[model samples]
Target: MILVAADRVLGRGGALQLQIETVAGDAGVEVDAVRARFPDVLALATAVLRFRQEQWLTGLAAAAVGISEPRDRILALFSYLESCFMDDDWRGCAFINGYGELGRAEPTIAALADEHLASIETHLRALCIEAALPPYVADGLSLLVQGAKVEAAIHGTTQPARSARMTAAMLMSVYEPAREDLFI
Candidate 1:
């Protein structure tokens, strides 16, 4: 319950931005209850981030399930991200927001974010290899998706993903001469 409340706090700002009392109120529990579970905000924040990582990997699997084609599978992942950007319940990624807040100040915090990002990179690299494209494609597409998330949050819209997806498709087609069209 405390983790869920802290996750809600994460959308508005960084993970550690909220006070214990605020999180307690959000959790509908007493401050002591929250403290009993979490000795401090840092502990609570770390737990929430860890919780978010599991959810993210699970969602990533679901996003690509039942999709066989390498390119379509990658695009399906991007489209899933598009829908996620549009979701009203969860605005920004917990991992992104965490790094934005902590930066290099905390190694553990940064690792949490890096681990999540590497998971995305792994998925992208797999698809790129499957399509017989250069490994650089995964790196490029990963940056696009990361930037798209920040862009969507800044503009209060999800057009960034659409634009990024188009750019990705074009890049793939341009790099592979045999494929007439990669854009969907």
Candidate 2:
């Protein structure tokens, strides 16, 4: 039911009241019980944001299987990006959507979303370091990832992920000359 709520809330641009009512109707519970369970809408939104992040990270990890080489890891990351774009539940990004809907009206929700993005950035940075790539590469890739998400949502296609992957491969070639053969 929480998953349903998250999807509806994000899909409808953070209509918390409506989403809660919908959840209540779907769950056959009273609206008051839903409210009692989630006294703070922002808190519920935060949990949904965290849940979305975990979903993304889990996908990334699964895509990165047997990825020992840095170049392979980059490819894996790009594959993950494509998968995210292709997901039936894809709606830009949960954090970005949450921020767009509630950032101005609810600072706490915005902060939670910001923290979630930062966590993703930190994880990507760690991957860059593990790959022995320059530190800035992580930031660059993070931007690419975000851009691809937005583009994918707007175009309703996975082409953005493919484009980003090609660009990332070029960047990787420059960063690790020894791995140039891998890309070819």
Candidate 3:
């Protein structure tokens, strides 16, 4: 529903300029000064920065999809996201293009995005350690999970997430037969 709402807003606004202005206004920010001074490209960069910061909170909270426990939150969020973007043309999506468009103009957003991705990757690596997996295998798992996010977005399906889960389970069977550390 949030994605749908965002899509609606994007459709109605027609341009990043309008979207930024509306978003700023919704947040009760006086963007008039910024709007008057910066060109559309500049404003877009600023909006992208703000958008990424906001996304961090959403990502951490698992978008409030109702799974409150940390482990459940991660699984549910990934599961739903996998289901959400499971479209046939997901791969052809312009995620990189859009990311580049935002990054080229907004260095701050680019930097923050890099930081966020790294933080999340570390979180995954820590989970691997908790599962008692070897460091290299844990790193591989972390990369696999991260890569699945991109794959899910590109393929528009939950298959990537499911694949990640299956792969993780297989690795666990080899490295952690007891499943003593896993909560679920």
RMSD of each: 3.8, 3.5, 6.8
For candidate 3, lDDT tens digit of each residue in 81-108?
4544554433311223344545466566
Off by over 4 Å in 2: 12-18, 177-184
The candidate that wins on lDDT is: 1
Q: Can you rank all candidates by lDDT, best first? A: 1, 2, 3
All candidates' TM-scores?
Answer: 0.88, 0.85, 0.55
Give the runs in model 3 whose Cα sits over 4 Å from its true position. Answer: 1-77, 80-99, 102-106, 177-184
* Whole-model lDDT, model 3: 0.51
Report the lDDT tens digits of candidate 1 across residue range 51-95: 888877787789888988888877877787798888896667777
Flag the better candidate by lDDT, 2 or 3.
2
lDDT of candidate 2 vs native? 0.76
Decreasing TM-score order of the candidates: 1, 2, 3
State how far residue 45 of model 1 sits from its true place (Å). Answer: 1.1
Candidate 1: C-alpha RMSD to true structure equals 3.8
State the C-alpha lDDT per candidate.
0.83, 0.76, 0.51
Residue 22 miss distance in model 3 (angstroms): 6.6
Error of 1 at 164 (Å): 1.1
